[model samples]
Target: MNWDRIEGNWKQMTGSVKEQWGDLTDDEIQQAEGNREKLAGKIQERYGIEKDEAERQIDAFAAKH
Candidate 1:
């Protein structure tokens, strides 16, 4: 799936994001608001992972969706 589709459907996607990154709070995901960079940042903060790893995880998630 394209990032554009993900962004366009952000509200619907939140549940999947929560399932994938359980550490992230709903508030954090809402704050991200479909921005890839912001979502990556939240994932990094919640998972204690590096930026690259966060982005990689996001890529995998996007691909799955």
Candidate 2:
């Protein structure tokens, strides 16, 4: 469940991402395109959370999948 694996299987992973961040639009998820930084930025924008928090959530998510 490393970032590289997640990035490589991004299309399959999109569903999980949406489940974790229901506020994100389909377009925003697509914009991330498997980039951790981009996904964190989108999460930050939608949730009004700090960058660190967003990244932490992503880390947890990555660990799960």
Candidate 3:
């Protein structure tokens, strides 16, 4: 989904997001503010993944129902 849709639904989606990125604290997700770029950055920072991989993982997750 696009950033607008993601941001709109962030409150509900954050729970799933937190589950996906177990290492990220709630505060970090809050700081991301539903921006996909920030979320990808945080995922890479917290998980030590490459930027491309982090984006891919997030895109994949976002595709899920």
Residue-pair clashes, model 2: 0
By TM-score, how accurate is candidate 3? Answer: 0.90
Model 1 collision count: 0
Q: For each of the candidates, give the backbone clash count.
A: 0, 0, 0
Ranking by TM-score: 2, 1, 3
Error of 2 at 13 (Å): 0.4
- On lDDT, the candidate that comes out on top is 2
Q: Which sections of candidate 1 miss by over 4 Å?
A: none
lDDT by residue (1-65, candidate 1, tens digit) is 99999999999999999999998999999999999999999988888999999999999999999
lDDT of 3 by residue, 1-65 (tens): 76578788988789988988889999999999889999999999999999999999888888872
Candidates in order: C-alpha RMSD to true structure:
0.5, 0.4, 1.2
Q: State, as a TM-score between 0 and 1, how close model 2 is to the true structure.
A: 0.98
Runs in model 3 lying further than 4 Å from the true structure: none
lDDT of each: 0.95, 0.97, 0.88
What is the Å distance of residue 17 in model 2 from its true position? 0.3
lDDT of 3: 0.88
